[model samples]
Target chain A: MKYSKQEYLDYVDKKSPDSPIWKNVLIAFLVGGAICTIGQGFSEFYKNVVGLSEENVKTAVPITMVFLGALFTGLDLYNKLAKHAGAGTLVPITGFANAIVSPAMEFKREGWVLGLAAKMFTIAGPVLVYGINSSIIVGLIYYLIQKL
Target chain B: MNKKLGKQTIRFANGINILSYASIAGQKEGEGPLAKYYDKVLEDAEWGEDTWEKTESKMQKSAVSRAVEKAEIDIKDIEYLFAGDLLNQCISSTFGLRDFGVPFLGVYGACSTMAETLGLASSMIDGGFANTAVAVTSSHFCTAERQYRFPLEYGGQRPPTAQWTVTGSGSMVLTRQGNGPYITHFTAGKIIDAGVADANNMGAAMAPAAADTLATHFRDTEKIPQDYDLILTGDLGKVGKSIAIDLLAEEGFDMSENYNDCGCMVFDIDKQDMHAGGSGCGCGAITLCGYIMDMFRAEKIKNLLFVGTGALLSPTSTMQGESIPCVAHAIAISAKGE
Candidate 1:
């Protein structure tokens, strides 16, 4: 080693270009806000025009977004949008839909059982596991407080 | 009497001649600057194959067959086939070339497989072990992305330092007999880990190794940067190319005038939106086989220093927080053999 690892890392940091975080963040914010706005539109339509209950509207809005996400992923447009949109497209329900559908479509050749069914959770499985587990922990803490 | 030069360099007594070479590029590569030089460019990434791995295999097969055809020789006439790819178990080379029934040696040097295979094949031919040999390597954008990074459809932002894996293949037929453009020397690189841990910034990881091998080649061959018309590295991209230039300058070798990287040459980085240009086995392979070989045939260059750089890190090793270990092999190609 001509230089220490720290020195080499410092040199690499100096040489390598950094990603445009501000641009990415702005795009992500706009795209995310747009997606949410569309979801709100759907929510309003279902609640007023379709005469759905508040609970039904909540379910209907996400279902519609997930459907659009899966549809865009199937059409192979979501990833392209996400390329520039970054977290704007990824932090929404549509992103969750894309996460599942993308791998499902990709692994379709590997067969349905192991490829599609098994590997479907490659990205979403961790989120589900942690989300549910943390919610359970929070519920338990509330339950203890109520008992006290 | 010894063929071995100072340190890790080998001066081939009988110059290994490059008979013919071919390059097969995918749709993305076809849109690049060297698109016209490629022997064949597929309009689709899948290449009508069922899978990306199979598509990579098809590319290797096409490149090897084309090179052999251009050489005006039957596949059986080729004694050995040195090939590899970015896929696990080198599936692209094995599955692609298996039907050819040529004696095969699978090599692995990450993106440097082209130079590694070429160097080994040239040695075999120069040492009279084989009359003719073929060196080939391929990499697919789809296969490499899914295997090395994330799912193709996974919506994750790639850093600016991230390089697009080239979807292409290149093959060269080398023999004991040919007109010109002979491989005169081989400098085997030592694996050097400069402790770059980021997997996305491969150029940074591999730059130090490229510099070391180039400096060693110059010292062993008693040649300077001015001796070669062009000094090309495999896939060091923009960042690594500049870093390599600085590192070599520190070693008292000024390469600023004639130095370029295959990574930077293959793609129109700004226009194509290729963040750090191109990388992968195919980057060096196709650039050498397509554009560089055409330059040789046109007599644009005489002496050339072709260095293939590779970052040796697996997804598992990277996840384990291991730094990328890199190597670069240099092959001196000249228009005339001594």
Candidate 2:
């Protein structure tokens, strides 16, 4: 009843905070690249020294990284790392593990079944639901293409 | 002043006085800009409590007790206490002040609870119902997140739209006669839903209600934004702040010069990693009780409009895909004898 919507929009545009693009991008890149390099190192060790098949190495690398991530999260060290590393810590598989364990640990006070078990998946729940759904759709499409 | 302005606005004839107030914050909030303004800052979020919930209760208790102490009043002299929080059953307030032995009024306006308590407490003082009243509210980041969003340890990434719940508490002592900011008028808000369903974007959900209340206040009082030295909305972080600014402009009040959102102003968004900004009952309560009240006392600000906005949605409601219903209450405060 006072001013027009256009006028309000302009005010908002002027007031929003500007992100530090160069700094964020540089950190994200360095952190993301570093995580990938570590993952690659694990893969190389599994492939050459462990004498594992390529398929087995592919699975082992992520599993190892995820285990480390979850372990750091359990120790409450991952959050501190994320705080300083910014998106660097978030770019790796460790971030996913941290995400799952953080909320679960936060809710442990409400009891095991309702608190921990239920909330353990709060953030990851949507990701899993959509991941599975889309995978099913992709698998069906692959099947159709193969048949054709 | 006219006691009643319109359907929702009320003006106090005998201006209710703010005798004293206190603010207490957890570690994160203590690191913010208004850090120096608070009465106490907890070294840890738990404040020596066993659970985060209990910690929040202790925060509320400390805030009120400190305010009462600052006001130089005994607990028994306080006629009533008004308090609330973002907890189920309002347990934070109930248990926090159970030992105070003051007649209590539990309010739940989500983040807007600070304004709600002040508005109601002011009315009671103006109506001569009580000689002295205390208004307090609190919120803890760990407890609110666990109750409304997810578990504390959940490493789930918060989107930029998500706001950090402020871990703090604020309390105010209002008396029939005192020297401080005067509770001049207030415009009660309506529950407004712009059909926003995303719980993560609380600011966006609560903006419409804030806009509605501000416009109503302006209309009822026949006043413009320039009438007040400052105009603030509670916890409409960066995102909601923008929305409210635009809405107020549309209502023909250009507040760009003197307006700010408590949520956005409390934290350094880029440096603090506070995504959008701060949200919670404590965000508004601490800002008003600590920052704004100090301004009034020092004569830095003469008159101001503080609109406390809230998103009334439980985790259950949001989980059921229900839209967030929001409300904002606007109270006009002026420097004493103004």
Candidate 3:
């Protein structure tokens, strides 16, 4: 009895257990909201206590968050948190910091140059590339519209 | 003296015995249900090594030494050694066993390496090519994770189908001489692709191959599932095991009884938070060497069918959207050589 590719896929899909989408969404929402709240707290601290300008406060908040992310990754706690948090940790700027620091730390055994520096951007490199290119295209369209 | 049985099965005319076996497990595995069965469980994943790859090599080294020591044979007496691991270029096996100075043959059947090595080693002994040989395989959780998935500290969620790779190693000493629990038949499996492209869902990718090999083994040996006291597949976990059972049932073989998977047995799935169950080359190797061997020695199981299953897909292949190609190899071991 031979099963075609589609038949086999359908059978596997039916047999295999699916992830709990509703539960995951709920967790991700709560945790992601909590992280954003923390970021807001940092923004308030920088603006009021530190007496920083609006733009500088925005920059300081993200830097602090990235720092916390890298520190947690180094302490080996972010992955543990992200395990249950799911997209909660990933949707934040902290996730980007983890994406960079993790490979760097993991491959550090190879060497400082080839291992840590070269592979640091493996995950986040694509995000940067596409993000910057898309922004430039948008800026060019805005400039053309203004000229017209 | 034709040893060929059916299309894929080989009947050993001369007795091929498992003289001794050993298992070394990691901390997580040590905390599992089969903890007491393992020869030694390391508290550290690194095993005092600088890297995870080195730790895996150390595990293979320890496993082989323990097996050889239990067999009461010197390393020099062993004519051939078969070993492998789930590392690129099989560096763990090569680096681990290099110091022994034995005739080494490195094999790669993905996670099915244990069965592949055993089948080859036993065949070598039965064919009079070697009087004594050893089969060993190892897999490290960290090493496998870094190579196959993401970095250790990378924050990502695994789906329900993802299996935790077992951090362990197992080795078996096979010789032409022993009293019982001899390898009677070997059935090599074909590469079966069931169009599963998800690397995380390894059980689904490998189930069809396992089912095909098991069915072929039964057909070639002309033995029913009732003939064996136990039928075990390597690292099918919960998902693949059920799929395999259903596939076999469709082919008129009822595997609802006497059929379990090493993946499910090696770890306490519910308690350990191992989504699907244990996987990797070590999953089958340790289960067979540690728990199942004790069962054999105690005469609890007279007949056993061990099938090692493997999903042959690399990260590159998965990235290319290619389906996983899987294989399974079955070896029939009987206490009375029946």
Candidate 4:
């Protein structure tokens, strides 16, 4: 290491205390808490207000979470929040939102170049890759079952 | 008194044509601070290329075409055309010159295309390869966004290192005639990447590049801040511009007075609502074409230093966890009475 542990610590201590770390943590709390509260509210709605099955609501939760993330991400509010919070706004379902929105946002600025064109797939890229692969496997299993 | 032994060399712009420049962005119909959004300008323009491209080409053609008209020289009168843009293929500039009907030589220099292209054209002229040429470049938020940002349709988060796209273009006609404009000096730049930054804010992303170019220009020309009528930097914005001045000052160069940043000068900082004001290659180019031309034509300012800055990162680089690498080029444009 270039600097000793004590030296590194001293350097960091002298560094500005106003780093994004604390704000990022707060963003995690605020966004995470908000999402969690929404989950609880959804569960309650299914359990009491809607009389829906728990399994069904559980399945629907991720979709709603993604939708909320997308909406906030679209409004430019989420991005501004993201600037201050960094990964805090990005780690959860918001990450999925960011994945989709970020690429599109970049491309939107690009016009129709490969950057923008490629961005269309950026946000949902992982979901499609994993989901398609799993579905293909599931379909093969179903086909074998029918043949057997 | 000592005079340098270097011989004079001049290049002319030739075979330059404007094929057609088209793109759009920004808010559609609103006046005020919110319109300061780079995307809003593109969205408002409601076309393809970002504000930087649209603004740059329009201004470029506006002046160049006029100069063409003033000199009574047809587009074909230009033998070598030197041009560039803040784009991947230099499309904004290539397409900008598409309709003018002349040969095109693509040039690339972040924001210093005006000077960079002029330097090239002058070399060609001095070499007797061409007689007249036009050096042009255009920048737009829409085109730049796609190249540097996200698709116009997709929403993305930007780091502070990213800068708002500018909306303008600039072009100049370089001729063999002594009565026309000429490039007085040229200084190349070195790539500088200081790793402490967020990628979304371009001013920070390009600060090091600006510093390097500015420092080199002063050193190479042996000129101080007060030597030029105006010392301008291309698209440094508020943050990068300040950093450039500070960095130069560290080396005993105080450029606050005779120095100006293109990003800071174009739009009203108070009214434009841009966090850092104007930017992109178009920022300086348009200012030069629109205002600087008038000043130069009238012989108001002489021995001006124009430094253009650029961040050399593609979107792929950022997505791949690469930090931004930046470069800048400086050109000195002057009109000494012949």
Question: How accurate locally is residue B113 in candidate 4, as Cα lDDT from 0 to 100?
Answer: 71
* Candidate 3 error regions (>4 Å): none
Prediction 1 TM-score vs. true? 0.98
* Candidate 4 lDDT score at position B306: 77
Candidate 2 regions off by >4 Å? Answer: A1-37, A50-63, A77-96, A112-114, A123-148
State the iRMSD of every prediction, in order shown: 1.2, 4.2, 0.8, 7.4
lDDT of 4 at B70: 56
TM-score of model 3 relative to the true fold? Answer: 0.99
**Candidate number with the higher TM-score (3 or 4):** 3
Instruction: Please give each candidate's TM-score.
Output: 0.98, 0.85, 0.99, 0.70
Ranking by DockQ: 3, 1, 2, 4
Quick one: best TM-score, which candidate? 3
Q: What order do candidates take by lDDT, descending?
A: 3, 1, 2, 4
Docking level of model 3: high
* Lowest lDDT block of 10, candidate 1 chain B: B146-155
- Predictions in order: lDDT: 0.93, 0.86, 0.94, 0.62
Worst 10 residues of 2 chain B by lDDT: B150-159
Instruction: Sort candidate 2 into its docking category.
Output: acceptable
DockQ of each: 0.77, 0.27, 0.85, 0.17
Which of 1 and 3 is ahead in TM-score?
Answer: 3
lDDT of 4 by residue, B1-338 (tens): 22111222121232122221111223421233223322223334534434445554554455457556656767778777788877777776676677877888998777667667766766666556876777767676666765655544343334333456666555666655464445655566677776533455567667667777776666665668888888888787776777667668877888888888766766666564455566777676666665565666567886677777777776777878876677776666656521
Candidate 1, residue B298: lDDT: 94
